[model samples]
Target: MAEHANIPAGKGRSNAAILVACVAFVAGMVGMSFAAVPLYRMFCQVTGYNGTTQRVEQVSSVILDRTMRVTFDANVAPGLMWNFKPVEREVMPKIGETVKVHFTATNHSSEPKKGQAVFNVTPMEAAAYFNKIECFCFTDIELKPGETLDMPVVFFIDPEIVNTVETKDIGTITLSYTFYPQEETKPVAVLPAGKADGNQKL
Candidate 1:
């Protein structure tokens, strides 16, 4: 009789543990689903992967000896009222050669406004082969209404770019940019195969 009573108690304890485990499993799955968007954005930023805005601060881990992609991002303020673009559409420079690209920011706003530009390069396959000489993405950019100014990005193709046979096929490379609002921006711009018009990269 004692053994029968103990068996029932043990079974009840086992059932309670199973119920707790099931609840935990469901909660974990729900949490993962909620976190999916941010996680995906992070992946794109690191890989230039899904075209979504990236979250990586910098690309310092790439292997310089091999080939990689050189990616760039640009943003402008909405209140500033400006027309901006990278001067040069494409380039194919020798390793270690410095290249300059311009972003022409023209304020059409009726009133003078102040804003800053945020820019960065994603030297995807060429992270090691890439270096920035001058860039305006840092610090806040101040502009007056109806003012037109050119922002510059002075950079160089690392000699290591030529060392890798894969990058050799890259006779033509693209330096790209996009304008964003002053506050923190969301990855929402879906730029098509657009041209910079007359802007030239130096």
Candidate 2:
């Protein structure tokens, strides 16, 4: 009877170990899935896949005489209570010439709101050559109620764009930005005495 009992106890310990191993494997997979999102976005940005634009630190040194028409588009996602639009509809910029464009955003909600902008370039092939030096899309924006802000984006088209067979003939490139609400909230800004709204004194 004692020998039989020992065999069953050993089997139970082995079964428990197997269960733990399986649980660990599942947790690791879940972690990888979460990590994959940002990794995939980085990959697209680097390769210019899916119209994702590239980020650069400095302005282009070479400016081509040939100019290209670039258009702007702005959108607000469903959850964010903000009004967003490009200050300018379009501009003609010479290749490799740095240009700055502005977009305005106003928070219509009563409370402070945070949002992040995602951007992309149209004519898919042009994304690889459309580089951004400074962009508001890089970080989250926090705005107090009725606060309006002008956001700027500085970028230049790569001179190499004219050399590429796929992009050389492209006439116009459209840059679009969409704002979405952030999951985390930021601290609200305190208003001064007698100041009820962003404008107008009590």
lDDT of 1 by residue, 65-141 (tens): 43333444345545547777656555544445555667777777776555665433433454434455566654556
lDDT of each: 0.56, 0.94
Alpha-carbon deviation at 79 in model 1, angstroms: 6.0
Q: Pick the candidate with the highest lDDT.
A: 2
Per-residue lDDT of model 2, residues 68-172, tens digit only: 999999999998999999999999999999999999999999999999999899989999999999999999999999999999999999999999999999999
Q: How many steric overlaps are in each model, in order?
A: 24, 0
After aligning candidate 1 to the native by TM-score, how far in Å is the CA of 175 from where it should be? 1.5
Candidate 2 residue runs with Cα over 4 Å from true position: 1-21, 185-202
